[model samples]
Every structure is written in structure tokens, then in C-alpha cells.
Target: MDEKTCRFLPAWDPVLRFLHWWNAAAMTAMAATGIIFMVCGPDLPEGTEDALVSIHASVGFLFGAGVLARIIWLFIGTETARWTDMLPISAHHRKVFADTVRFYLRGFRGETPLYLAHNSFAGPVYLGFFVLAAVQVASGSSMLGLPEEIRSKSMAQELHATVFLLLLLYIIAHLVAVFIHEIAEKRGIVSAMIHGKKTFTDDERDSILEAHPLAQKGDFDERKD
Candidate 1:
């Protein structure tokens, strides 16, 4: 491929990328503390459990704030980052969603549809994750507010645990998918999240730009002819 035929395109904005990694770190910390709590149970020293709980709560609060920031960005960010971009509201997008699913089902061996932002199928899943996170936050808050006598008996802890488990599974699946894409498509999916840019061939860039005109707003159109 000629050097001119490939160019770097802005994918994630700086704020969005920062929030992504911030939430990732927060969640990782929360997960680690949670696992320790689960494994140590009541056998640990007197203050160990309380200390773990404190760390978990602190990271959880940060994660919740990050989620809120992301939700606000959905409404105020660029077209690629907006809710409309992710949702399959049009017939064309719905068709693309179906095709993307079919491509995945076929073992992801071939070129799947290229999307400048999140794929049509992934939009709904991302939305679902947000909802789940909100629920987990609410339940955790409720658990913390309850009196000690009732806290253990309250359903909030169970609900929070369930949502956390679901979120963990989602995170695992998401990481696996990214890994597969890195190996199969080699589109720099992970690096794009880190550096806020993606490399694309001329044909790929043309197709993406045709589908998402707003993507050309930033450095996307800075390519040499």
C-alpha cells in the first residue's frame, strides 16, 4: 500500500479516551478488591474487610462519576460520540447491524463492515452496560445507607453483586472481542482507544466517510491525495 493511500483519522476525542482508561482502572481496582473480599470472607483480620470495603467504595464512586460523564458526552460530544451515532434508528443502520452480526457469526474470518465509530450492534450493548452500571451504583448506595443490622439482610447487596457479576462477564466478552479484532482485522482497535486515532486505507477511509460524513470534521480529512 502506498503511504499516501493510508492516513491516520481521529477516532476518540481526548476526553473520551481519558474517561475510557479512567473507568478501566477504576473497575480493575474494584474487581480486585471485590475478589479479595470474596476469598478472605470473615477469616481475615478485624480491619482488613473494612479497609477493602473502603477502597472498593472509593473506586466505585469514581467509576460512577466516569459513567455519568460518558452519558453527558453522548448528548454533547461530536456526531461520532453521540447517542444517535450508536443507535440503529434508520433502516440502513438496522441492515448494517444485521450484517455485522452475520459477519461475527461466520467466525469473523472475512472483512466485516467498517464503522468509523461503534458498530451498529455494539451501540445497544454499550447502552445496556450504562444502564447496568447505573443500577449497580444505586444498589450499592442503598446498601451503604442501610443500618448494620439490616444491611446484611437487605437485598441491595445481592442486587449489587448480581450486577457486578454481569458487568464482569461483559468486560471479559468485550476484551475477548477486541483481542479477536486485533488478530483478525489488525485495525488498531486497542491503540485507537489509547491514542485517539486510527489508521485506515484510502478505500476504507472513503467508505467510512461516505457512511459517516461528520467523521471528516477533525484530522480525518488531512490525508494527502
Candidate 2:
């Protein structure tokens, strides 16, 4: 086993990356279109306004579809991407989990737990983001689920507004989490998400508590970079 392959390894598979980027793109398009529909509503007529709304509904449906696909993939995916990879699922690992989070609380100080999957606590952060995003998408689509024959403009507007606010807040929190981890953890966690590489010191190998990224790999010793 390569000594360099420690916890928190780059375990995001190609399919996971595909779903993430695709969902992001669809969501962006939906937000932009929804914004235009809202801002231009003042001058729009009953017919044109209705058409714009239908488009928004379509976008929401697509977003929901992507979310569903990702959720399913999460279950059937590789061991690294599976739901179990996010937490210390076994009862025996509880205290080790505590110590791992304590290490983060201490700036990943000293040798952290060698994680074969995700760090004991960091798992929750990722899971929280998924839950929040799913909720926002679902709530946003509820308005569309209402009958078009009795469509309520005000209600639709409110749903869009609420979803946007929650989405904005969640995204802000996500960025802040990434920044905090990178600065405090010294692991380049965010960059690893984007580029699939993390900088690790000798101490990092000892302290990491993830499974896939932290698990032993064969090529690390020969690769200088």
C-alpha cells in the first residue's frame, strides 16, 4: 500500500461529478429564467405570463429529476460514495469519531484519526447540504403541482421567492463551510472537491479518518506530485 494515500481521499466518482455539475447547471438556468419572469411580470399579459410560468414549471421538474437521480446514485454508488461512507456507522467507532471531530476543533492538530471514508463529523455537513437542497427544490415545485386551471399567481410568486431565499442561504453556508475547512484544516478540502487533489503532510496521513481517500493506494510512492 502506498503510504501517501491517507484518509479523505479523492473518492468522487465520474458519475457523482456528472450529477453535481449537471444539477448546478439546471438550477442556474431555472433561477435566471425565474428572475426574468418575475421582473418582467409588471408588463406581461395573461397569455404571455402564463407561458413564462409554464417554462418555470418545466425547469423545476428537470431540477427535481436530477435530484432524484443523484439520490438514487448515492445509494447504489461505489463504497466511497455510498451513504455509509459519510458516517461512522458502526457502534464500535463512536469514541474514535469524537476524537476525530475534536481534532478538527483543534485545527486538525497532531495525528488525526485515519478515516477510510469520511471524517466522523464532516459527514454530517455534506448530508445537511443534501437535505437542504432537496427540501428547497421540493417546496419550489409544490406551487407548480397545483392545477394550472386554477393557477394562483401570488402563490406561485411566493413559492419562487421562498425557494430562492433558502437556496441563497444554503449556498452561502456551503461556501463558508468550504472556506472554513480549507483555512482551519489545512487540507485544501475545497480545492480537492474541484480538482480532486488534496495537500497532506505526514501528520495528515496519521490523523485523517476517512476510508476511501485515506485507504491505502498503490501508486503514491512512485508519483512525486
Candidate 3:
């Protein structure tokens, strides 16, 4: 569609976009190194395993810092990027969440709820991801800091591995959901993350303008600035 005719809304701020990508890259690196450490460390030449472990630890620290920055941004970010936006606290939000669930349960047959940012149903899942990441950091740090004898006896390693597996599953599910949204809804789900804007259909724009006038205005102002 032509720019003059199409309605584009700012969905993610630059900082949010940066965090999304930074975290994605860091997580992917950590996952790769972690898997190699777990699966190939035993067979690798001497010192290689230790190097991998060191690399994983360094990446894990960076990822932890990114997570902390994200948490801070949750409070300072734009309306759609705030923690409140991801939570279904209001009745309207809950209803939309239910509708979103129904949209998927019915095999994408019905109208999907349009969101300027994340869908209501995804808020809880995002929260769960944050919690899972925190757990991973904690478990990993605990294991890394423990003495060799204590490390062998402690459950931190097991907890760390378990959380990493869960994180892998979460990443896979997240990718699948992104593809589903891209193919089924044609929402530019992936591009939105990269470019920080979401182009809405005429109907979607109208719905958002009517329901969230202030939010629309703020988005427009931010884009103009």
C-alpha cells in the first residue's frame, strides 16, 4: 500500500527495539555455546571445554545486564512498551485476552484482536519469559561461584540445565508464534521488531484510534519527533 493511504503506528520505541535485538542475539549466542558445552565438552580437546565455559559465562553476564535494563525500561518506556501494557489487569484487557485465545482455539477462523504492541494473551507469556531468564541467571551464577566439590554436590547445575531447556522451548514456541502471526495475520510481526513500527489495516487503525486516542497521539508525536 502507498504511504499516503496506509496507516502506520509506532509500536516499539528505539530502546525497546534495541533491547529486543540485543537480547535475541545474546540469547542465541548463549544457547549455542551452552549446547556445545553440554553436548561436546566431554569429547573436545583439553582446554576447549574450559574456554567454552568461560565464553558462556561472559555472554551470560551480558545477557543478565540486558535483562536488567529491560526491567528498568518496563517502568520508563512508552505506554505500549510499559509493563502495564503487557498485563491483563482491566476487564477490557481480559476480554481481549479471551478473544485472542478463542482466535487461536478456533484455528484462526475468527477475527483476531488487533494490538498496537503485544497481544493481551502474550503478556503473561512474556512475563513468564522474564521470570525464566532470571532463574537461569541465578542458577548459572550459583553454579559458577560454588567450589568444585560443592558444585558437584549442589543442584544449581541441574537447575541451570533445566532452565536452559525451558528457555530453548520458549524460544522455539516464540518463533512458531511469530510465523503464525506473519502468515495468518499479515501483521509484519518480524519487521515491527526490526523497524519499530506496525502498519495497520484501515479497520485496525480506526479501532485503535477510537479506543486509544491518547496512545495514538503519543505514538504519532514520538514518530514525528
Candidate 4:
């Protein structure tokens, strides 16, 4: 296993990538429409606000469906897609999280730990996103048919706006971190989401897959001769 040599292995599965990009598109649409309402104050000329609301609601429903499917997949999807792999609660994962923080603190100058799927630090952040998405979906759903007066003052409305802001912040931070990780590690972090593969050195790959059996490549055999 030469230090310069690397192996391309499975990271995200097909279903995971599809749901990821689908939700990303849906969120972008929701954010666009939401920003319009926030900027124009819901008093757009004629029926413009209504039209935006329709678009927002339709996209929100699709986002909600995608979120639901993702949650279900966390239970039944591939090993990398499962909840166990995405929670940063284990001792090993906590160490990975600490090392990741140090990697950032050092200005991306040193070697960072390798992960086949979501990095340990990112796993919990993703879980938080799902929680925020759930709240966003529930609050938005509750406002669907309510009277304008109640809708304006409802708890649902408040939660919806707050979750939107939180998600906006999350998106900004996520993008920055991803870009930095891609540049620093040269691991194809951005492209991996699209192609479901990541490059790892032979030693890194073997050690990671061996430590986390579930992270083993789906098509790779582990049986000893």
C-alpha cells in the first residue's frame, strides 16, 4: 500500500444521492419563494403573493415527502445511509469530531481523518438538519388552510420563519465547510455526493473499513481464504 496510491470506494448509495439532490432542489425553491415573501411583505401587486404561496406550498410538500423518505431510509437504507453511521455519539466518533475541529483550527494545514461516508463531525450536523426540516414541514403544513388572521399570529408561523433562518445559516456554514474540506483534503467531497464514490489511500481505506465494518464497500468481499 503505497502512500501515494489511492482507491475509489463507495460512499453514498444511489438512493441517498437521489434523495439528497432532490431535497436540495426542493429547499432551494422553498428558500427562493420564502425570501420573496419576506422581502415584499406579502402585499405583492394583485395575485403575485398568492402565486408565490402556491409555488411555495407545492415545493414544500415535495420537500416534506423527500424528508420523510430520507428518515425512513435512515432505518432501511444501505449501511452508510443508516442512522448508526450518522450519529456522532460513539467514543471513536467523538475523537473523530475532535480531530475535525482541530483540523479546522489549524487552518487546514495537516492531515484530517478519513471517513468513507459522512465525516463524524458532519453526521450530527446532518441529523440536526433533519430535525429542522421536520419542524419546517410541520409548521408549514399547519398553516395550509388557516384563516389569514390566525395564520399571521400562529405559533406555526413563528416556528416556520425561525426554522427557515436556522436552515439558511446551516446552508451557508455547510457550503463553506464543504469547500474547505474539498480544497484541503483533495478528497472530491463535492463530487462524491454526485457520484457516490470517494478516493482514499490504501492504508486509510483498509483501516477505516476494518474499524467500521458497516462502512465496507458493498461489493467487496471480506471473507478470508
Candidate 5:
């Protein structure tokens, strides 16, 4: 039988918590722009059209900065924030990821792996979406930065339009994944990222960090992936 999820486990470090919440807030702003950008499509109230695009561009810039800061922190940040922690590490991990997928797809949770930080099962899913977010934002920024002549550039237009289309699809996929993960798995992961702590069963916690002496220490948690 599965251990009940903990209501009070220490989850993320302070820095990790800060960045996560900050990024989430930025993402919300980006999401708003995403909707407006899609529906409005260069259309705005007569007096505020330019103002709206400017706001969109400014928000894009802010989100881009957040993304860049995250990259730098990925290199110099705390545990639970490193690239490796976010990605799968072994065959067992691959299996866990696959099983998680199968569990979601087939509506069966039998034999799923337990994870402390990123569940081996969900690791790749998180990594994939993060990558998609990075690409979407990058292409979105390029689109927003259309210098007069570059505005008409075929490559710029293609990148801007194509990335937007793909980003829309990715957003839908991301939301669906979150809802499914939440419903079937009973993990409020999206809200956890907001709250900055998730409870793990006692054994699951130990088994995961036991292999890495360094990971257990807050001092060494900042080491590169």
C-alpha cells in the first residue's frame, strides 16, 4: 500500500523557493499576454493599442530575464534546482518516467516508482515542458523585438509565428498534464511549486538522498549538475 503523503515535510531551500515562486508569477503574466496576444492579434482599444503591445513587450522582457536568471542559477543554485535533479539519471529512472506516463495514459497506477525530489516517473515530463517553455519564450522575445526592417524578415516572422503556435499547443499540453497528474496521482504539484514545499513519505526521502552524500548536505547542494 502507498504511504499517505506528508502534510509537513521540509521541501525546498529558501533560494529555490524564491526563484520558483518568482518564476511562477512571471509565468502567470506571460500567460495573460499569451491569451491577449492570441485573441487580440494586434488589435487594441483605439488609444491603447501601442500601450498594450508595449506592456506585452515589457512583460516578455521580464519573463525573459527570469528565464535567464534561472539558467544562471541552474549553474550556481541550490539543490532541487540543479539540472540533474530535474532530469532522469538511470534506467530505473527511465522506467519510472515510463510508468508514470503509462499510469496516466492507461489510468492504472500499479508498480509506479517513488521519488523524493522529482519522481523518476515525472522527471522527464517536467524537463520536457521546461525546455518547451524556454523555447517558446525565446522565440516569443524574438518576435517582440521586431526592429523595423527585421519585422518583415521572413525568418523572424516564421520564428515568431511558428513558436507562438507551438507554444499554444505546449501550454494546452502542460495544463492537461497538470490536471491529470493532480487528479489521477493525487499530487497537487502545481500548487506545491507555489507553496514551496512538498511532503514526501519518510522512506522515500531517505532512499532518494542516501546515494548522494553531497546532496544530503545543504552546503554542497549548490554544486553543478
Candidate 6:
């Protein structure tokens, strides 16, 4: 942790961070409302079901918009935020990905590969999340357009329910993964999403710079530098 051996870098852009928290809040609201309906069933008071549905639908729209914006950002955002970073298209990326898998397989022990933005192993997992988000949006939208009686038994409703379950599982897995990484790497990953910076050792910094010569560096903090 010597200042001379570690550095802080700007890893996430402002727009990307905003969308991340925006979707998080929206998803939390949607999940809360959805869980209430699942637990309450038909035993709820008079207009409670209708009120919950309205809240869920409103949150769904925000979540859908956030997902769409993120998809677009993957193409037009910063070098670290683009599809290039998300996919193992290059040799360096593929190598890092393999090392990452090995690290996880070994129970988060040993040397995990360093990444300035999304973890190479997590990139594809995130891609899957986006795909699920798209499906959820489509299914929910279709259900919204259907008649109440038909909506309950429709294919869209079934898909929506199934995807919601998958999403819950995904959330649990994502949190576990993040917890492991934060403990193992001690890289300020959780804070990176909020403040757009990550800490790296001097050797790690050099390796990343070699791989990404143009990687953006954040303003130096004398205490951290």
C-alpha cells in the first residue's frame, strides 16, 4: 500500500455511473412491488392490487429506459465502457478472461488479472443481464397492452414471471461475486461505481498501461499516490 507503488485511475465515466445507479434504484422499486404482489396474492384489500400494479409499471418504464440507454452507451461511450471492453475480442482480453475464470475456480485465491473497468470475467455476464433486461421489458410491455383477464394467463405474463425469477437469482450471484472480488482484490471496486476511480499497484499499473496505453488516469491524490 505504499504511495509510490499504487495509483488511482478514472475507470468509469459519469454517464455510465449515473445509468448504473438509476437502473439499480428502478430495479429495487420494481422488485419490491413485484414481491408484494407475489406474497399478497388475492388477499389484498380493495384497491391495493391496482395501486401496486401502477407503481410497478411506472418503475418498469424507468428500468426499461435505463437499459436502453446503457445498450446505446456500450457503442458510443468511453473506451472502457464500449463493447470492445465487454467482449474478449482481443488476445489480451481473452487471456485476462481465462485468468479470471481460473481465479474464481480456485475460490478467489492467487493472482487475479487486473482490469481498469469491468472485470473481464464479468463482461459477458453483464451482457447476459442486458439480454434478460430486454426480455423483461418486452414481456412486461406486452402484458400492459393485454386485457386484465388475458394478461394473467398470457405467454408474456409467463415469460415475465420466469424472467423475474432468473433476475432474482442473477442479483444474488452478482452480489456474491462483487463481495468476493472486493475482499480478494481490495481494489475499491464498490466505490469505483460511485466515484469513477480504482486503485492499482505500480506493477499492475504498468501492465495495464502496456495493454491499454490510452487508459485514462484520474487526478492524483497525494495521500493515495
Q: Pick by TM-score: which candidate is best? A: 6
Query: Model 4 over residues 158-189: C-alpha lDDT tens digits?
Result: 99999999999999999998988898877687
Whole-model lDDT values for every prediction: 0.79, 0.62, 0.79, 0.84, 0.60, 0.84
Per-residue lDDT, model 3, residue 94, is 73
lDDT per residue for candidate 5 within 84-140, as digits (tens), equals: 666667554565576677776666555444444566555555566556657766766
Model 6 per-residue lDDT tens digits across residues 41-64: 578885888888888998999999
Q: How many residue pairs in model 6 have overlapping backbones? A: 0
Q: What TM-score do all the candidates reach, one by one?
A: 0.91, 0.64, 0.90, 0.91, 0.72, 0.92
> How far in Å is the alpha carbon of 61 misplaced in model 2?
3.0
Could you tell me which 10 consecutive residues in candidate 2 have the lowest summed lDDT? 216-225
Among all windows of ten consecutive residues in candidate 5, which has the lowest summed lDDT?
A: 216-225
Worst 10 residues of 4 by lDDT: 216-225
Global local distance difference test of model 1: 0.79
Error of 4 at 163 (Å): 0.7
* Candidate 4, superposed: residue stretches over 4 Å from native: 1-4, 216-225
Query: lDDT score, residue 56, model 2?
Result: 71
Best by lDDT: 4
Q: Taking the tens digit of each residue's C-alpha lDDT, what string does model 1 give over 79-189?
A: 678888788885546766887888789988776767776778878888898889889878887776566679777788888888889999989988887887667755678
State the RMSD for candidate 6. Answer: 2.4
Error of 5 at 196 (Å): 3.0
For candidate 5, list the clashing residue pairs, or say none.
Answer: 96-121, 97-121
lDDT per residue as tens, model 2, 110-218: 6455443355566766676567667767666666657655455656546657757667676677666557656665666655656555656554544443333324432
Q: Could you tell me the TM-score of candidate 3? A: 0.90
